[model samples]
Target chain A: MADYKNNTIPGLIGFFLLTYGLFFPSLSAEWVSFIIDRLQESMEIMDSGQLLIASFAYISRNALLYFLIYFSTLLIVSALTKNTDSIAFSFLFISATLTAVFLINEFYGESSSYAPHFFSLGLLLALNSYITKQRYYYLTFAVILFFLITAMQCLNLIPLLSQWSFGADDLAISLKTADSFITEDQLFTALYFVLFAIFFLIAVIFALLVHLFNIQITTLKRFQVQEKELKETRFALTESKVYEEIHSLVHDLKTPLVTVRGLISLIAMKYEKTEDKKLQDYLTRVDHSIDKMNEMISEILYENTKKEIDVDEFLRYVISHLVLDDQKIRLEMEVQENLPYIHVNKIRFARAIANLLENAIISFEGKAGFIQIDVKKVNDTVRFQIRDNGPGIKEELMQEIWKEGFSTKDSSGLGLSFVKRVVENHQGTIFVSSTPGSHTQMDIYLPVSSGQGGAFYDIDHR
Target chain B: MKKSSAVIGCFLAGLLLAASPFARPDSAASINSYPNLPAPIGEETILFTSAGQAPENLLLAKMAEDLHLEGDYRPRALASDLYDYRTLVIIVGNSPYGLQYRNKTFTEESDRIKQLLNEAELREVPVIILHVAGTKRQDNQTVELIETTAPYADYFLGLKSISSSTKIIESMDAANVPVTLVQDLEDLHTPLNSAFR
Candidate 1:
């Protein structure tokens, strides 16, 4: 968790002090063994027991040296750059793994050999960060650091390391040096270091590449989700397109129909004056068909585009305009006075609601019946329930009731279908239930307001 | 570039003269630990980060070679060729197992490991995970996943002792392959950890 570069000195001091505390005598005695070991083969300066003691002493001192350097470096680096950026995580993981490897190698490893595990750990950390987010220059720096490591390690793994003997202390040639005491085998060791360095560096690069691929694949999935959302938003916008096309079609038809009607009336008036009863009757039929077509177009346009009008005002307009068969209708109305302004296209909602009420009014088959209309705001919801005491719809026809043109006593089949569309556009739910003679009920649930200034809401059916 | 040239020189020289004159492959190739022992080829060993050290990588490589498997020092590279070989040695990667090591988010890097482990099962590859493999339980999902995955492994060897009954310490029971503790090999140097090669 710590990233320090400058604080490493104190950290190094603390680490060495801790390790040294565990082996003060041995660390102090390490130099003695080291000196004797150098002159060993010729003079046999140390005995087997002394040599054993010396090896342990050397290992303890090395452990102290490593602990001091690694922890101190970690502390300073982590401290200098408080680990906030994404790379910080990688740094900590690398440092921790390095520390673990160093500790294990220190406590249990051979005195004559070394392990480059921490170097690998460091490289993995740096590579992991670049792969995590794929910033540009990260990989370039990684390659440079790797090259430096390989070059230095080669120096110690091959003969150049062993080429320097007991008398070569004055060489002071390179800080990248291996154990000076083991001068005879230095060449072999240096070579080993170099080969291992290159191989391990390649391995680190390989891990980074794999990490990069996985990140890209995961991002691809997110892009796919965004694409799906875009398609849906476009589909939602299509409603407006269709409505515009329908309006223009109505306007075009109306102009031609008005001309035809005017011409027919002029002809019919002239013909009636000449005592032609047949022509008058035929022209009246033509006039009726044109009136019906105009009415139908208006309803379709109103239903398609949902713009709300006042529920009370819209209700009165529907009753006055669509007075189906006033005979069997015993109309009863109950509505809340505290009702807020509803957002629905007035023309569309009025036609849809009237269509349903008209169905209820005429369902008794021209027989006398009671029709109930209730609109009340309960809690945060406004519910519209219409019930009638008629023979109720036949059980077989219940499912078919909402389908266009499936009406039992119908003219055009579009009325109920239009009602369903308007209700859905207002973000409302509709339910239907019927009992033989008791009643047939059509209930609706809709939100009174949407707050953001639109009558429309997202509609989903599952 | 000079360093590379020096390396090439040393490599040729080392190839010519073996570290010990008698230990050359041509000479030692005939030596066998068992009657059917195969000559050791170039090793594709991997040193994983399990046990927070490179124990998985090092231990797995040693065991693989002992069992006549081919591998090398860094196992990450083998990621590409994982399914190509007859047998492979894997040291489990590092994981935040103990509460002392818990961080904020989950580390699914091991998800790659789990993928390889499953593929190995299909290809009949037997893998060995060290002691740290038994310790990953930071949440319910991980605990469930570990339990789910434990049954798929053909040979599950544990480096340290575990508490579960079916989890024996290496008696070679397949239905309940146990954790086996092997005697330590040469421990590596601490100074070498921070050192270059």
Candidate 2:
């Protein structure tokens, strides 16, 4: 059996010893006193051998009564409840047993006073842990048991349960009174049977409660898990929807842009021998717009790569996508060699940084702009600072730039938000600052192995 | 709890005393000099260390030598053993001892040395570690253990080179106990010689 199962035997012995020591300091002497007094009273009625044997038998019987009552309390608890919360109940049961044992060893044994309350509390607590964890069930069981036990006590059914007892005269009178109402042997017999019934009733209630609530708790937990799964499903659906919309939009625009480029090339071919000022300027402007469109499409396609991409590689890819004709727009990076990699969504994050490049390029629309991208590993985080000496975003437009779809141009303000999403996903952050004509700087922060050089303890759920 | 702890403590002390054959301290260990006396006092503290097995006669002989204000060099015959928590207890048995025992505790002395260190610490005594994680078995953890234990000591020393940077000190604790590095040992001579005078 488990440690809690065979607890009563030791508990009962401990209780007996504890109470015996506390109340009856001189236990053996007290028992001798009671036996001697009894012998003196019945001295004339029996022979010496018979008197000696009878007195010894009487003391033995009283000792046996204490053990019986102790065992009976345990049996009642054991039979009535299977839930172990009854440690407190068992304690009360032990206390009552101890008190009852002390009283029995007394010359004039009487009924116990606290027997009903402790038995009620102990049984209820133990039953609470086992039978039902619900507050109402516990309160209800406690009330019902209390009333039932109290009702049994009124009928002289609760053992070691009686009122004031006088001496021998009182005992004789009470027995005679009890005999007149009912047979002497039948008084506690019904109570004993009722106690057994209480035991069985408690056991049955305990089993049923565990059975009912076990099902409820398990069902509740399953439902919570399902709810979490449903939430994740909704998020995944939203992401896929956004992805589908962008992919189709880019695909449809590809054909028209290619046709427009073809027409521009045809015009340039037709005017191959002509050296007119207006024609050259028009052709040059047309070529520049085509370059811009091509770069935008390239950015759109590259942004859709699903795998995690190295941040530095993604930076280089973004620069290449820009199609910079002027060597000045080609960003010079002071990146350290073989830098530690930061976790990034290749497509989405590349798009965000690419948009920053696009803005820098546009700000220099008529004049050449010098853009510099620096990637540094400081301690454990990667810091990417993209600086541009473009018409550094107008002071009034700076705040509105990051607001989604609130772009100065026709494109969505989603680029910065997308960048934010990528940075946040990598347990990092982004910052934007513009000196309004001197330079515009967008800095992104991403952690690399958490500052402890070389190793990160990953709780890998994937 | 106190009685059980005391019992374990006594068992730890008795084992350390029994294992070091040269560690037997005569009552008048003070009236003796180094390299002539069976055991020397007022000498540098010597600690024999390896992996797995606890140094026998580890702390007592040091403490007994220290009582007479001698250079307390406690010698330990190291038995290679490895105690790891994430993995099973792996005994790297390449010591001078002829018998090869696995991860299991070979004797009571080995089992109690760690406790002896803890007890010695309670009394405010410096612990001299002499771990022998040789070149054949060098790693990050061995380097870390060597570095961590070095600072708490008044004069830090090691028997074997754990890293390329650590300088090996040829000075003995007196008699034949060898230490690899003796940081701050030069500063100790003035006070030691004054006491000697």
Candidate 3:
């Protein structure tokens, strides 16, 4: 459509040439008939009345023919070009050219009976353009102007045109005579003017309506865009406020843990020289548990505190966090030899994996179910696969499970969403596949750490 | 682009030059063919009208006045207009614009003319068919009108220069009606004057 509009000028030129080429001969024939009839009248072979009627008939026929040809050509050109603007422009150009020719003929002292007919044709062409392309104010103006011009020309009210005498060179004078005869019928003459006025009013009202409609649509689209932007800004503000509150709450938790750890160290020092080994060992285990808790707090408060941990060691930490006391559920683990270490926040990464295991165990609802964990290296990353034979997640609920506050069970729905956040923060990816009423599997890939330490590095927890 | 424009201009010029001759009216000498029988005459108070509502009725009306023929001119005269009329002179030609201005379709016009002709036949009013606009008025619709009105017409008058004058002559000959083919509208004055008185 844009391309068609862009080429409108060229298209107009082409159509103008086509219209002139097609109608030239018909116009010429009308002129020639008028001249011949006048000559016959001079020879006393035909009377003035017959000459006048013949001239009127020939011009009227040509006018009707030209109207048909112009209308059909516009339709065909519009169809071929798929451009109404171009066709309307072409029609206007041709109509103007015809009007110019009529005016030029009149100025040269030749009275053309077909001049008003051609002007009327121009009025019709303008009306067509106004109706089809009402958005263009120029076309509406053209319609109004053409209608007035046609009325003036038809009524012989044009001061300059009325001064000219009917010459033998042009046959269109007979049309002027016919108009005089028609005007003698007062009702018909009034009705004709009324019709033209009505059409002009209709064109003006329609153009105004179209203009208002376009403005309304533009305003509506603008409001829609602003509404969408406001929604996104409000959502982002809410997310940031939640993160700020969580960070403040976690920072306050470190104070109490620090005092408890210092008191336990003091008690261990007092019992160091005594022969009480079991008590000493128990105290050491308590101190180590406090340290692990502190590490988890650090992981929550900050995201960048990460260290490399062996894949197998990470799996053991995850299992230790889960309670496997339920008899209806069984757990299995498989770790490939020489698996690459993954760089991640140990406490949060283990907690995310533990949440998955807990969800799997809960899915059993006290029914017998088996959960299997597999760790292996592929390319530059380590993958963990956790499979469970239980009531699997439905296809529709799979994506929803990872959204905050979305859950199908009687629990806070933050488990999967938290897991997804932790994995994404560590630049890892998680995927899930499930068969409803059968089994479910989850795969997590974490990029391997560049550093290599002892093959069996351990983190103690009591 | 300039070359293409020039070529198209040349092509269009050739077409215009080629079509100029065809656009001119036939320049051959007019032929006047009359039947052997004397022209039929009708009483005064003739009804001058049009068969297909052409503007030619106005011209014919003027011609009737010039010939001192007393008649009423009704371009869209209905069958009821035939009251007390002794002769019906209908100018036969079709103008699409004329029909449109009068808010009539070809079918309605044809039916109206048929009704008027039928009323004339019942009233025994002498009907004369005139085809005066020459070949410019000859079309399928006008030809059909002529054919439909021929059988009821008592006399046929038309121009000799029109190409379809042959068809009009043929229809009149087939209907066994006397037809007068004249050189121009002026020549129709003599025959028309004779027919009225």
Candidate 4:
């Protein structure tokens, strides 16, 4: 977007400058006349030095006027239209008319000449350019018009040069022989025509050059966007490959870990009456470690593919499983009735919510705790807020809680980080606020429109 | 009823007859008036650029040349030898730049033109006054030159833009000098041809 804006201003300026350049000769003539009128009051005679200075001043004054007009018009019209093409066309049409009038008035005042012929031809080309849809055709037409006008001016010199070669008497005789003749008038008219035509041709070339530069800028911007997208695709591909290897290694260990848990449960049931406090404590610790490992493996294997999920059903399933595992923690749920369907990866979102519930239950350390979960629609977002009345998180730790490999008390540092990843994968945001001794509230917001969701994840992983 | 119709017919005829003299042909429109001056011969017509050596003299000289008159325009103030020319053409307009080139003041240029016109009068060389292109240098000297010399001109040729004002035309009319107003500089050829013939 920044690149788009950056190129448009130059395009408008180039168009205006070209128009101004084409009309510079006539404007310069006016400047010279104005300066001479002002100077005549103060000085009776103009020395050669003064004359040279005045001539240069005449050209400078015209250039200054052209800049002032072009810049101001560009600014005002650009502000009004905002679209580059609109501003350019408006400036082009106005400038073309002004240039035509200036040329016509300068060349022949109420006299017949070849100027009108070239003027009409140039105007027609410009009009045709307006009708053409392709930008290149428009530019080509403009170039041809400027070149033709210049050619006409150059051609006018042929008759003039012939008359110049003759001596005054021969010229007079030749002029006399001609049926329709204008002597000195034609000379001055043709001279001004050539002058203005050259000015316009130079202007056209400058405009074309600026236009080409604008095109380069636009092309560079597109290239940059493509380069960024290519980098992202490569990174995603590398990450997916690494995850595939890790998932296979962890899958083999999952079977052995499940068999060990089954054998421990069978032995514990057989020796149910044996009262060994140290032995039971050690067994419980082992059970917790195995559960943490399984949870880590499950998080690693999680993939977030977008699909419409019923908020109430997903939350009820998550709460039922969490309640069974931690019977001491009482779960109070408030789900808004007639809840809107949410588009997301249901498994990833449920994991995020379950992580928050587990964190709330752990904060009690086996003491009875109240974990409240609320879900409701807010504006264009579906919001879920989980609150715990256990000893809340410290303010200093809150900032560091979501960092990867940074955990308060964990065997692996993947718990909160995994939760953050799942929430983000569903294009939802999670934030927590706590008053250290009172309570912690973890709020998650997901946009109703799931444009940010990774919809093609299933195809990529498969 | 017949008598009334006859009266209306006579009134309409009177209106057309009155309009006929004012309705000039396209060729004659450029000629304001042509005085009864003799046709200029090749050897007797001399063109003088007065007051500032303005371009008007060269332009009118071209016109005269095209009319087959054998005289080139000259920037001359000393009209003492004017007796050789039968028709004297003085192109008068004051340009400060032209005066600066000659190192002369407007008063000096105006005096020289008055003196030259007096010389032409003394030599009995009929004068044709041309007020052709430009209104830029219509300083006091230009107006003075017109007032002082136009009365003596046998014929006056002016472009429409230059002579649209009745001031100079009225003065020449009082002097019984013929005046011609050309719509454009190109229109001057017809009256000039007639004058040369």
Candidate 5:
């Protein structure tokens, strides 16, 4: 998460900057020593109240110095890496280095008064690294801890500093000459215990705050995901309701279509032997138109009714529905031999193919154009590729062409959407490829039926 | 059994006898080691102050009170405080911490002591130098303060335990200032009481 490989060098640089800034001459450490010396002098002459006030000032000054160095290095590292996690890692690096320095100083018996405070700061920084997600919360806690630790150091309350030369020696010297010094020492010791309790309480409170914040964030994220799912469910429900209404309307229209078809059949039978040939041809054409309307109604109402049919027969049925009355367009068909049979709804699948052909023809705008249809077995699916040389679909409108109401011409835009739905319902995939002002290609793959093929073609003239 | 008890008692007596010389009263030895002052060198109403901003001035003030001597303690006493006092008792010791607390550099402290001593001389008040904190206080800063204030002092009182007491006494003797050495802090009241009226 920290991008360790990329951040290692910058992290190390930050660590060095922090370490050297604290310990280098005329830097934070020297400034702290100067202030400590002044505080020690003040402690010798001041009353109890003045002493407490001076100690607070001393602690604040040292805390501010350390914080400046620390925060500056943190900012520089953050800017260099431009990663949120890197700040935590850099803090960890700096804290560890300071800890090592503190341990070494402690082992050699040359520990400064502030060494324990640095060690405490390192522990807090390590805690910050462990909880990387809550950066702001941990950073605030770390700053507060830094101030408290600095106060602890200035008061000489840390056991190691107090028991050693800096605090103990001064106490021992004062003890020999004044009882008031004893009282001051006892008072500081009590203050130290009180501060220690507060430090522990603050740590607990910080942890609790982080926990509460995490719970709140998790709940918020969960609510967002649920809200998104709810919206999608509502949209799908509305789409299903519309489809149900359309299915009912198409079913109602089929009853009237049957009555008209029956009447035409009866009329054709009565005029079977008429001597006027033009009237007979007109009646035959009207019968054929009635059959086409019936097929269209079936396609809309029973799209899922499927059966196995030969790819060649299916293509033929699809081609028969196309009106190639325009003389300027040439349609070519290529069907590979021994192709697998496809399982599909005859009325719906044929109409879907006819819709694609009709779209290619309309793209020509009455100009001379070529349309190519190819049928082949690709693995287990039969791929039908339709290519047109008319002005191709624009790239930006490729996806829009499949929507239920999208069209470039003065017509209802249901053709491509219906084709896409029919193909998908029969376990097929369709893809379109086009270059603007050049050519458009559509490829549809339908899964091969596993069962034996059968002649299921039905043209109901009635 | 009786003879064994008598032997144990004799061993314990011998141990005490051997420790007796090391445990002699330090005040008696301190008095025997130095000659008493010819007479009380200064009067009451003394001004107790520090030449080097040392806390010893506080201890000297306490010692003055124990001897029923009227005195006021001011670790940072200026030359103006010398007008009402008949005798000035200056504690000579350096504490860098104390100097810093008073916000005075060593040079500034020495100058203040010099001015106070000059004012004491102008007022014809007797100046007594007390160097009670022993060898530990004999740093360069304290030694410089001693050199600065020693020329105007009528008497020099120091703890005998100080390693540089001989040199300090030699300088005071060369300056014809009376020198008194005490064995410890408690022994300070003897010379202090005698020096006050």
Candidate 6:
């Protein structure tokens, strides 16, 4: 697990250059022996220890020559480009040029059998990139390219080579031998076969290594993502605990307020026909204020409890409460027939709808306006569009509508924001679109119930 | 890099000169090694046994097949009757240890081979003589057989040690026949193919 990312392209090139310097000598020597024997058309050159030594010396010199060139190139590239991608581009250019030169020389009888080495070099380059970026696809691409190059080189073996002058007698014998096979070119044939075997083995090993490595990397990445998600969820859970305490406190306050409202009602009912009618009117206002407070408190406490309810019944209940409070605004509701039960907090959902209706009523500003609530089952979810024909919100204020404590009118700006929060808590979404003087539409979506047991509300169920 | 390459090049050139006597540019001909082997005389060839009993004629035929040479191997046929053959291959050795010729005695076989060589010489068919049986065939009788038949051959292909004897070497030199000496029995195909070619 050394970090290849920190390794620069020039350094990688230098490393490969060092590798070539160490290993290419033997390969080059073998190639030289093959070339000498092929030219002689006899094994005399191969048998002569002197020729082998000369070949080894010659190949080593050449290897030394190229290695120095590459090493200097690496040094220059690293010095100039440093850790930049330009070095990779330059190195690839150099490698491609070198590979082409070597291959041409191999085919032209200066040498033979550099393909497997080039293949290995290419695999190393690709593997370097893959390891640095942890991108398995790069390795996959390299493997494919390696096979393609090998196959192409194998096909190149089909042609007869530019042969050696093996005396006239050796040439005649070689030609006779050549007549029986597809190509009389034994050198090309031998080189490609050996190269293919070596490359094939290398490809299999590299593929296995890449495959296993990719699987490990993918699994590791997936685990890291899941761990991050778990951490975020745990943090959110801790934060939600604070809201639960506040909701409990609000729930507790409702009991005393209800008792106080009952006492105020008794006082107002006893003095209904009294001369002090002002007191009676004030008590009635207090009762109405208490009722609003209770509704707000119930909305706050409406967390984590859900029940399956008929869509039509739920819409009717919300509409009944709205119509009783304001008979001036015309309220219209349309529910699709045979709609499935939705799993959600009925009270909270109703409060959210009620808030929308209240906003629509206030938009009318005592002038008659129409509010339409449309409910239907679409796919696996229930959709509700609450549209109002009041003076629509300006486009400038639209984006700010969902912001907490943001309002265009004189009031506490928590109603629409709270509605959005409640809708989101039920795994649902609400969208709004409006045009000035035309209409404003609020569309809400909630997932339909799967008929599993939920935290049922007795009042809603009954 | 340039300096290192120069130093390495000088060292390698020095090593090359030190290791090979023929490393001199003018000695290029020495590197080609024994350039006077017989040229191939087209595909019309026949592998004819001189001693008549060397069962290796079949083996040489298989070798011909392996070398991709188109030829017929007839151990008992008269060379004069082979009008279509361009070349005659005479295997000049006797098989021992239950592998000898049953049809003729050593004298009869040698006479028959002498007749075959005369017929081949008259017909102007190039003859390739192979003394591949090594030391086993260099007995006094076999030497006599070789002396009679080998001087008629255009090429002498055999083991180096077997051909190194003063008599055969002198005979080869006198006949102006080029000798291609192989190391072992299986190595005969190189020289064989060279003769056929």
The most accurate candidate by DockQ is: 4
**TM-score of chain B alone in model 5:** 0.79
DockQ of 1: 0.01
Cα deviation of A314, candidate 1, in Å: 9.4
**Fraction of true interface contacts that also occur in model 5:** 0.00
Better of 1 and 5 by lDDT: 5
Docking class of 3: incorrect
lDDT of 5 by residue, A15-102 (tens): 6666554553233334434544444444445445544544454445545545545554554445454553454444444544355445
lDDT of 3 by residue, A1-462 (tens): 876664575456546654663555445554545544453342233344544455444434444334433443443455455555454444444544455445434433233344343444444444444345445533454444433443333343211232221121223333323333333224224543555456456555654566566678778989999997786567557767887998888888788888999889899888889888899889989999998888888987878789888888888777777787845787899999987668888878888899889889888988898999988887677888899988888777765677666678867667888888888777777878788888888877776853422121111111
DockQ of each: 0.01, 0.00, 0.03, 0.04, 0.03, 0.03
Descending-lDDT candidate ranking? 5, 3, 6, 4, 1, 2
What C-alpha lDDT do the candidate models reach, one value each? Answer: 0.46, 0.45, 0.63, 0.56, 0.63, 0.57
**Each predicted model: what fraction of the native A–B Cα contacts (within 8 Å) does it retain?**
0.00, 0.00, 0.00, 0.01, 0.00, 0.00
Give me the runs in candidate 2 sitting further than 4 Å from their true place: A1-221, A304-347, A350-381, A384-462, B1-197
Per-residue error for A104 in candidate 2, Å, reads: 12
- Chain B TM for prediction 4: 0.72
Per-residue accuracy of model 5 over B1-197 as CA lDDT, tens digit each: 33233234433443444343344333323232344477887887889898776543456665666788887888888899888889998988775545654677878888889999999999999999988655434455677788777789888887675533455655665677777776656667777787765
Question: TM-score of the candidate numbered 3?
Answer: 0.45
Which has the greatest TM-score? 5
In terms of lDDT, the poorest run of 10 residues in model 1 chain A is A166-175
Against the correct fold, how does model 6 do in TM-score? 0.34
> Mind giving the per-residue lDDT tens digits that candidate 4 earns over B13-131?
43444344234333333335643235642234565566554423445555665666767566664676565666677776654444544567777777777778888778777787777
lDDT of 2 by residue, A207-267 (tens): 5666588779879989999997786577567767988898888878989999998998999
DockQ, Cα level, model 4 = 0.04
Q: Which is the leading candidate under lDDT?
A: 5
